[model samples]
Target: MSDVPPPWLPEDIDETFDPLEHADIEPSPETPLIVTPRGGDREVGRSCYQVDTQHGRYLVDCGLSQGTSDKFPDLRGLQPQSIDAVFLTHAHVDHCGGLPVLENRNLLADNAPVVTTPPTASIASLMLEDSLKIHRRETDGSSAVQQFTSRDVAEVCDRFHTVGYGGGRIEGVAPVSDVEPAIFQLGNTAHLLGSAWVVIQTSGYRVCFSGDLGGRATHLPDMSPPPESGLLMLESTYGDTHSHPSLSGARTGLWEDIERAIQTREPVLIPTFAIGRAQTILLIIAERLHTLSADLRDRVEIVLDGMAVEGTDIYHEYVEDTNYFAESLVNRVVESGETEPFFAESFTIPETDQDRQKILTRAARDGTVPVIISPSGMLTGGNSPRYLAEFTARFGNASVFLTGYQAANTTGRTLQSQYQADQETVSATIDATPFSTDWPESSDVQWVHAENTGDSELKTRISFSADWISLVEGLSGHAAQSGLLSFARTVAPDTIGLIHGPDYAQERLGPHLAENVAGVDQVTRSRRMTPIAVGSETDVDTAVISPEEIDSTGYTELEDQIDHLYELLSKLNEEVASARNEPGLSEAEIREVIQDEMEIKE
Candidate 1:
C-alpha cells in the first residue's frame, strides 16, 4: 500500500482534460425552479436545500437533520416519487448526509440526476459509508432504519453528472425545472473543493446560487460569478461584519498557539473541518513543523480524526482532475523530522471502528504524545468528540486546538466554553452562559465570504507556485469586496435579491452597493421558512404582493394538510410548539408536508 500511489492518480495523467463536460444537459426557459426543504431550516443544524425547476426539479443538498421530523419537515410535500434529482454540493454531512436516505427509499429510482463535482461524488460516498457505521453503533440495531446503504449510494453515483467549475451544463437535464433545458455552468464558491455557485439562466432570470463561499482563495478553487446576472442569490454566512480578519496576523497567531500547546508536552487536538480547511491545516502543519527540532517533532504526533484524511485522499486522487487542488506539501509529513516541521507520524485510519478505538486507547496512554487532526469540524457529530472526551482532562499540558471555523450549536463551539466535560455534565464557569437545553450551542460558527474575482474563461487557469507560508495568515475565497461591488455594478439588475446571511449585513451591504452597481434591486434574505412578496418593475403599482396571511413576526409553521394524501398549503399557521401535536408522520408524509408548506411561502 505504501509503495503504490492511489489508483485515481496513475502515471498516465490527463492534465488538460476537463471532467465537467462529461455530459452537456441543456434547458429551456419555461421551467420554474421550486425550492424544497432538504434541511437547514429555522430550527438549526443539518443543511438541506433543494431547487426544483421545469428543466426537472432536483435537490442541492440532502443533509441529515438534528431537530424532530415535525420541526424539519421534508419542506416539499412533493410525493417522494415525483422528485427528479439530487445535486451534491460537497461531502459534508450537512450538505450530503440526507442523500443516502433518498437512495434507501429509492426515491426517483433511476430518474433522479445525482449531479456533483467528480471529487464530490467519490468523497461523499466514502463519508456516507462511514456515517452509517456510526449510526448503526449509536442506534444499536434499532429497527428504525437508516438513511442510505452503500449500494444505494453507488446507484446514485452511477447516475451522477460530473460538472467541474464553470464546465457548463447539466448532462441530459435542462436548466429549467419544467421546461426544456439549456447549457448551465458551475462556479467555484471555494467553501470546500467541490463546493460551487450553480449558475442557471432560466426564463429571464439568470440566477447564481452561492454554495458556501470560503473567506479567501489560494490553493482552493472557487466559483466565478456569471458575467451577467438577473438574480444573484448570494450567501450571507458572512453577511454580518467582516468574517475573517486580515491574513496578516492569522499565521503568526496560529504559530504562537501551536508553540504554546506543544511546549506543555500535552497532545494538542486540532478539530478540522473535513473539506478544504483540513487540507489547509495539513500543509500548515507540514510547513511550520520544519522549524521545530527532531526532539520536538518526535513528540508531536499528528492524528487524522475527522473525515479530512479520507477527504484528503479523495482530493489527492482528483489532484490530476483539477488545477486548483495541490497536495505536495502534505505528502512530506512522514519525512518532516530534521527537516524542521516534521510530525512524528500522520495516520489515515483503516476506516474501521476497532481501528478507531485503538487510536483512542493509544491517545490516552501514559507516554503517548502528539497532535491529532479529525473532521466533523462543527463538532455537532464526529470522531473529534470521542477524542475530546478521552484527552480533555488527561493532561494540563494538553490543549484542544481548534483549526477551523466553529459553527453554532456544535461541539467545536464548546471549546470556547470555560467548561470542561465533567462526568455527564459540563463544568461551565460561574460567569458562563447556562444552557438548560440538551445540547450546547456552536461557538465556532464565524463567517467569511470569498470576494468575487470577476475572473472567468472556458479554459483559463492561474499559476500558483508559492511556498506554504503560514496558513492562519491566508484568506481568499469570496469575490474580493471590490469584486462584489463590480459584479453588482455590471449586472445592475433593476433589483438584486441579496439573500443568504444575517439581515443587517445584507442591509449594510445593500446600502454600500454603489448606485452605478448595475440593476441592483431590493435585497432580501429568507431567514425563516417564510416568504415576502416578490414584486416586478412593470407591476410596481401592484407587483407581487405579500400574502396578507403573513404573521409579520415570521415564525409561522403551517399545520400539515393532506390533499389526497399529498401535503398542500394551509391557511392556518400553527405554533411550532404544536409541531407534533398530531402524531409524527411517516417519512413519506413528512416529505409531502414539507413541500406543501414551502408552496405557501412562495
Candidate 2:
C-alpha cells in the first residue's frame, strides 16, 4: 500500500497536528451549536446531553443508569464550572437521578439554576430523597464509592427554578456579551405527572429535545405540539416497535390476571415504578373494585408500600393544577368529592415491619387475597424484592406481576427471561431484612443477622416458581416508532439525532425517518462522546474523534453498502439458528424462508 494521507483529510493536516491541543479554544458567536452525547446515546439509561451554543453551555438531563456499572454520565472532559444551566424534564430516576451527583462533584456552576416545571420540582424532591437512601444502602459494604449525600440532594432542590408550560425567557443563565439571550419553552409530553419536551432558542438557532415522549396516558393532558426548529434531538426508546397494544386492552388483560388470582384465593404482588406506573395501576384497580361482588370487594385488601405512598400524595397535591393533570381527572375529583383519587375503598398503607408482617401472615394462614403494590419496579431495590422473597417462600399460589420496562441485568428481567424460556423455577439473590423471628422449620428460606451491622445487609436468597411470574405489557411511558415519526414531522427539522435507545432500535428508526419524513436532510443516531455540530446554512457535521466508536452515519457510499451487508448477514445467522430445530429442513429451504422473512421486515 502506498503511504499517503486520506483524501478526506485537510491538505495542511499532518502528524504534528493535534486535536486536543486546540480543545481549549472558546466558542464564538459564529460557532455552530455543538451537542455532545455524554450518556444515553446508544443506551436507555442515564439520559444526559451537553449542548454548547454561542450564549452558554447547558445540560438537558443528568441521570443515573439502572442495572449497569457505568451509573453516572461521563463528565470527564466537561468543565463543571462552565455549565450555565440544567434543564430537567421529569422526576423519573433515570432522568433526574444524577442531579445530586453534579452538586457533589461541583460540576454545576454556583449560580446556575436547574429549571423545570413546578410539579416536576415537587415530585423530584421525594424521588431524590428515596434515591439517596438506596444509594447509601447499596454502597454500605462494597468498594463502590457513594456518589452523593442527602445534603447534596437538598442543595440541588434548593437551586430549582420552577417554570410553567409554554414560552418563557430563562433568567440567571450566563450570557455572552453582545449576543441574544437564550429563550426556552416546555411542552407537555404526558409521559408522567409533569414530563415535558423542551425547546431552547439561542444564537439565532432553535434546538428541540424530545425528553422521553409519550401521549397515551389518560391522567395527563394531551401532548402539546412542539414548534418547528432547526435541529431536533429525539428519544428512540421504543423506536424498533411499530406500535403498542392499546392502553384499554392492556388494562383489561391486567384486570383479568388479578381477577383470576383473586378467585383462587392467592396473594398478588405487583412490582411497579414508584412515580407513574404505581399510580396508574392503583387507579385501574380502584375503578374496577365496585364491579366485583360486595363480599369479594370487602374481603380484598389493596396495600401500597415503599416510595409509591409518598409519590401518590404528591399526585393528589397537584390534582387541581390544570397544567399537571387532564380535565377528566379533575372532574372526577370534584364530582366524587374524594380527596385521594388513587385510593380504593380497601386501601391500606403498611407503616411498620409489624404491619407488613401481619399482611403476609394473613395471606399465608387465612388465605386472604391481598393485592400488594410496591416501588423499584425493576426489582433492583426498595421493598419489592423483600416482599417477593416473603411471598415466594411462604405462599404456594402467589402471583408476581412485573409492570414497565425491566432494564438489562435487573432481577425483573431475569425472572422474565426465565418465564419466557418455560423454566420451572426462578431464583434471584436479593437484599432484604432478616426475619425478626424464625419461621416454621418446613420453609426453605433461611437468614442470619450479623451481630454488629444494621438491618441493611441481613437478608439474602430467594427462589420462586416461574408459574407465578407474569409480565404486563403496554405500560411504557415512551412513544413507539410511529409516534416518533409524527413528532419529527411536526418539528420538520433539517436534521434529526436519535438518542436514548439501543443500537438496534436506532438502526431501524434512522432509515425509517430518512425515507418517510420529508424535509429531513439528515438522520443521525447519537454516539456517546461524539460531537454533532449544526449550523444555519451548512450541512450537518459529525466529528468522529475516537477510533473505538462507530460512526453511525457511514462516511461514504461504499461504507453504507458494507454496513447493510453486515446487517443482513447477522439476520441470516439468527435465522439459521432458529431453523436448526426443524426436522429434515434442507439448507436451500431455510435460505428461502430467511429471504421471505427479510422481505417482510423490509
Candidate 3:
C-alpha cells in the first residue's frame, strides 16, 4: 500500500497512536472562522449552520425540514459532543424543530445549552410538543424510525438559556475552557414574537446570521438593524419576488371575502400556521368585527381550534412584554384592559371532538357562517385536515382561505393549485380520525374508519365543489427582495451567503445582491456540506463558490436575460394580436411596431 493516509487520519500517525492523546491546544487568534452549512442551503427548511472558530465549535440553528426527503440537517461529520452551544433565532418549526433530534441522536453535548430569547423558548416548547405528536402519529404503523421522543423534547427545552433582545455577551456559554467567550447580540427580527437576528463576534471576526428577517407583520415592531459584520448569512425565502401585496390591501381583501361568505351564509375555513399567522389573522378579524353590519356580525361566529388555542394563550402570556410585541398591541390589549386582543366577542375554542362536531352541526343547521381557524398551515398535520375533511363532507358551498406558504406535496399545495387553476372541484386524501358518526352508504367521501382498520386514525379522500378557495398574499413572515437588499445594504458585509430559500430564489437573489449591494466582494448560494471561511486578514479559500460561478461562466446571468427577453416577446405578441383585432390597425403598422421593438431589444 502507498504511504498516504486518509484525509480523516492524522499525519505521521502510527498504530500505537492513542486517539485521545494530544499536544497542548492553544487558541490561535489568526484562525479563520469556518462556516459550514449543514442545512437550509438552497432549500427553505431545516435551517442549520456549523461554525468552527478559534475558541470553540457552535451551531447557529438546529432545525427540521417538512415535506422533503432530507428531513434533518446533514449530521454525517458532526460530533454532538463537540458543539458548545446552539443559537436559536426563533420558535418556528423550520428554525427549531431539529433540537429534539439533536438530543435523540446523542449529538448534543451534555454541557451545551440552547441559547435563545424567552419568547422563543416558550413557543418552541409548544411547537416541539406538537411536532412530536405528529411524528408519533405518522410513524405509528410504519417501519420508519422515530427521530425523537417526548423525553428528548423535554430535555432540549430544559437546556434552553433564555436571553433578552439586545443582551450583549452571552454568559455561561464558552466554546472552549479557559478561552474568552464569544460576544453576541440578538436584534429583533420582527418575523415571529421572539425572533432575532444574531451577530456574533469571536476570534477577531464578526459574523451576522439573519435568522428569518421580517417587517410586514403589523402586530410586531419593525426589524432592528444588525451591526456591520465581515460575513452575513441572510435568508432569501422571498428573494425572487420584488415586493408583497400591501398588508392593508391584503387585510381588506380577506375581510371582504369573509364578509361575502358571511352574507351568503357559507362557512369559511382558514388553515393557518398556529404560531404567527393564526394570531395575526385573529387580530385582523377582531379589529374589523365591529365594522360588519349588526345583523351579519351577530350571525358570525369565530372558532379557534387545535394547537392554535394553546399558541394564542402563549401570545397572551407575553402580551405585555414590549420586547416581543408591538406598542400598539400592548397598549390596545393590555393597557386598555382588553381581556384578549386576538379574540372576537363571539369566539369559541372547541376543546373536544364533540365540541368541534357541535360547532359544525350548529353552523350547518342555523346557516350562520363560522370562521374556523386551525393549525398545520400546509394541511400536512394537526386538526386542520380533520376540519377540512369534515367541512368538505358537510357543506356544499363554503370558503377555504390559505394564509401562508404551502410546501410541495402538502394537501394545502394541492388545494392551492386547484384554486389557482379555478377548478370547479378540489379533491385530496387527508389523514384524520373523524368524529363518531355513521355515514350513509351512498356518501361521496371514501371514508376508512379507524376501528375497521384497527388503527387509531383514518385516511379519507374527499372532494368539494369550488366555493371561494383563496390564497391570501402579503401575510408571509419573510421579507421580499427589496427588504433583503435593504438589509444587505445596511449590513454591508464583505461576503454574503444566502440560505433558507429554494434554488430558484437563491439563484435570483445571489446575483442581484452582488450587482446591487456595494462592498460585497462575494455572494454565494450556500450549498449544504460546503465550508466557507471568513476572516479579515486571511485570503478566502478556493472552495468558496460564487453565485455567478454556480454553472458555466455567466450562465445564471444569461438565463436571467433570456427569461426577460421571453417575457418581453410574450407581451409584444399579445399587443400585436390585440392590434390586429382593432378596426384601424394595418399589417404595415404592426411591422413598424415589431421592427421598433426588435431595435430596442438589440
Where is the poorest 10-residue window by lDDT in model 2?
543-552
Q: Alpha-carbon error at 404 in model 3, in Å?
A: 1.3
What is the number of backbone collisions in each predicted candidate, taken in the order shown? 85, 0, 1
Task: Evaluate residue 67 in candidate 2 and report its C-alpha lDDT on the 0 to 100 scale.
Answer: 61
> Looking at model 3, how many pairs of residues clash?
1
- Global fold similarity of model 2 (TM-score): 0.83
RMSD of each: 20.6, 10.7, 9.7
Give the C-alpha miss distance for residue 221 in model 2, angstroms.
0.6
Q: Among these predicted structures, which one has the highest TM-score?
A: 3
Count clashing pairs, candidate 2. 0
- List model 2 lDDT by residue over 1-602, tens digit each: 11233233345654343222223333455444667776787788888888776667788889887564438776655655767789998888778989999898787876788889988999988888987887887788777889899889999999888888986765544333335477888999989998989888776677899999987676777789999987788999888887665555566679889988888888999999999999989887876777788767766789999889999999999897778887767877787788687888778899887898898888777777899999888888888887887776678778999888877778888888888899998876665753335443425455645335655545556677888988898877777777787788898987788888887898777877776567777778776655656664433344222212323442333333333333234334433432342223333444456556556342
For candidate 1, write residues 1-602 as lDDT tens digits: 01122132234423232111111111223324333233353223355554544545456666664421211224333444554656665666656666666666655635667677877778777766776665665455454445556686667657666766654444455233433453466666556667766665545555555555552433453335555655554554444343244332344466566766666655666666666667766655654565677766655666765466667777666554343442332323223323222222344453665665455446556445656677655444566655544443333335655555554545445444323322232321111111121112232111123225343312111111111111232333343333344445544544444444444555445544423243454544333222222223211211111223222322111321122122111111111111223322333444456666556443
- Model 1's TM-score against the true structure: 0.63
lDDT ranking of the models:
3, 2, 1
